[model samples]
Target: MNKRQILQLVILIIVILAGIRFYIYIDVLRSGGDAGVKTGIVEGFLPISALMSLKKFLLTGIYDYIHPAGLTLLIFFLIISIIFKKSFCSHICPVGFVSETLSHIGLKQRINKYLFHTLTILKYGLLAFFVYIILINLTVSAIESFLNAPYNIIADAKMLQFFTDPSRTTVIVLAVILLLTLISKNVWCRVLCPYGALFGLVSVFSPFKVKRSEENCTGCRKCTAACPNDIQVHTKSRIDTPECFGCFDCVNARNCDDCLKVTSGMNHKLLPYVIAVLLTLTVAGAMTAGLWKSTVTNQEYRRHLNVIDKLSH
Candidate 1:
């Protein structure tokens, strides 16, 4: 199969795994049992806690037990970005998959050029704000306090509530975003997601890059037109744009095999296979090494949920 097809399959597997994990967690929560199995991957959604854990690790030299899996997954993705140029977005993230699927339903029109240029900086701005808040405002003590807060303890439950019991405003906002996604390609990832911005920053240093062959003599601009990120692939010998999610749309530009390739001192054709093998190994190794599950017990989780329930009432 082609790289794009292989990537789609990978995305599907991830989405299914995530769905099953969340289903089991929510079911266990509903059953009111301390013995219910929980999925630690759900903690990945709690980025705030992961950031606090990162700070705590830096300051105390202690690994995060509160949400170990989340922090590990975050680090894993960051490393992948450094090695593969944000393949996590194009190959693994469920949100990105959904966005890509929705983008297909819309007219293949670009966002307005002027507005797109202005809005593209917003994700970076959001990333900067997060950096300032986490690095500047949080001391070791502050990080400890926040990570151990009741709200933090029950954050997974709270996230479930956000979806299972969404308020009118939440529903409306989601609907609007959905509608907008059906009209624009990757609006959220391109303009709003700070996570993507962080990955993009790390991806700039990636050795793996799309290199255009100057000697091939094809300036057809198909690569540029095919790029979801709208990178000027025809004009540059090497695409170093941080916005690139390594989708390889440029390289996949039909009949341009010799004209474009992704490389990093190795065979570019093995890129997809390498990504798949690395991703599988990372996840499996983390699990076998006992870094894929939280230390927080089911009893502790249930107790925290009860407290949150009482507070809400």
Candidate 2:
């Protein structure tokens, strides 16, 4: 495995461990025991809540007390995209890691180009819908109300329950996604993830990008073939497309020296380590600021769990 893949594997393992710990923490609460473990890392999955909390924070000066870690992580990811060109998707996101792994084991079939482009719009549409609802439509008061509601307070627990006791529809939908990923590369990320779409948009302004030098061009298409996002790296002098993941697959695939280089960005060799250090610092800073954990107590979690089935948006 390459450095990027190594980083992804490490992050994926950490995420899995965090998930297990969170599950145990919630299980202890469900069993009327005080686990006293802080599993706020799972709040990374609660993006919608984080969005609402972010809006509220911008409108008012208050940070989300219930899921502070969610807001912190959302900000951290956005910043990473601004600086690193969607490296979070290729390096840190567990979903993207799973999608990448499935692509290796699966058929790796190619969809029609026209169909692929058409489906790519779906993720943008989802992102637009979310921006309309959370950023444009919701008033500060509405956001505040939602953030303070019992439904939002225990959103993390609800998310855990979702996987632990998935409905038939959830199972079917996930099965379809798994099948799709097995056949195609990054099916969810490329075609259906609003979070990735959001990052792609932000990454358009990123100073970092892939630059190709024609001086040493051998006209080989290895880089294009290596691109997981299917970006035609051989055709473009500069890859400014938001689809570029900056995972350095294309860079690593190049046979010609200096043919394709990441321009105006950290060196390809050190980018993964830089990302790792930044991630560590981000978490450490949040912890030092007392924003890495939620203010919700175990008793509150138990109380919310008792009535979570009846709660709705």
Candidate 3:
């Protein structure tokens, strides 16, 4: 009905559309693989082909960004994240953001804010574990299985097909984690998402983070209470906590504007640099997968010796 309400509605609409797109991708995969023409089967974002081909990128660090549907979207949003400090997670990450908005609305006046705040830290731990595995045991073939996953009953899945059935390990893990998110607050962004971790790292350099003019301290601690993420706002020198998701809720509060300014930290803030890194990864990753898919077709290896024999003759 007012300014805040209108802004909330706009954000809700954008986030909902993003969620619709993501959910549709999953359904298209589960629909016995017949994905109709409207499904963006050939389009870059809906194609689901890049994940399988990510093997090449994980192995050698190269990629193609023009073909697979997710490459462009991920890179595009990732770039925006560079300028905005994980704005995608706050503004567009459909599922996670939707849940956060709902929970914050109901709990704004609750007495147990600390309980929800502590619970969200779990996401950071989970995110760390995923990265540890990636750094230590990341195998291209194994990850390929997750992204391209083959279907048992359907033969038309253009997405990569691993043994015609996924291992179910990741599926179970993600399912349980999502169930936790439904019951808990911001479990994914707070703990489980590697993307969030990447943003957290870059956010350290975000010039426009919540800044407090110590001179204007009212000591109300309301900003801290208003923070859905539970950042310690009343007494922190630098508000560069890993938990800060750049949502701007604290700074936008009615009483907290002058106290907290989104000050610029650098002429070339960490935001741009992080965006560049993620974009590089997304683009390079896509290109690497595409080239591998084209050149290393299992058929090419099979024909290798046959061509060599002809050359010897």
Candidate 3 residues lying further than 4 Å off, grouped into runs, are 1-55, 58-67, 105-121, 141-188, 191-195, 254-257, 265-313
lDDT of each model, Cα atoms only?
A: 0.77, 0.86, 0.50
Worst 10 residues of 3 by lDDT: 152-161
TM-score of each: 0.89, 0.96, 0.56
Return the lDDT, model 2, position 172. Answer: 100
Order the numbered candidates by TM-score, best leading: 2, 1, 3
Expressed as tens digits, the lDDT of each residue in 76-99 for candidate 3 is: 654565666665565545445555
Q: How many clashes (backbone N, Cα, C below 3 Å) per candidate?
A: 0, 0, 17
TM-score of 1: 0.89
Highest TM-score model number: 2
* Global Cα lDDT for candidate 2: 0.86
lDDT (Cα, tens digit) per residue for candidate 2, span 147-238 = 88999988888888899899999999999999988887778989999999998889888887888998887879999888888788888899
Rank the candidate models, highest lDDT first. Answer: 2, 1, 3
Query: Using lDDT as the measure, which candidate wins?
Result: 2
Candidate 2 residue runs with Cα over 4 Å from true position: none
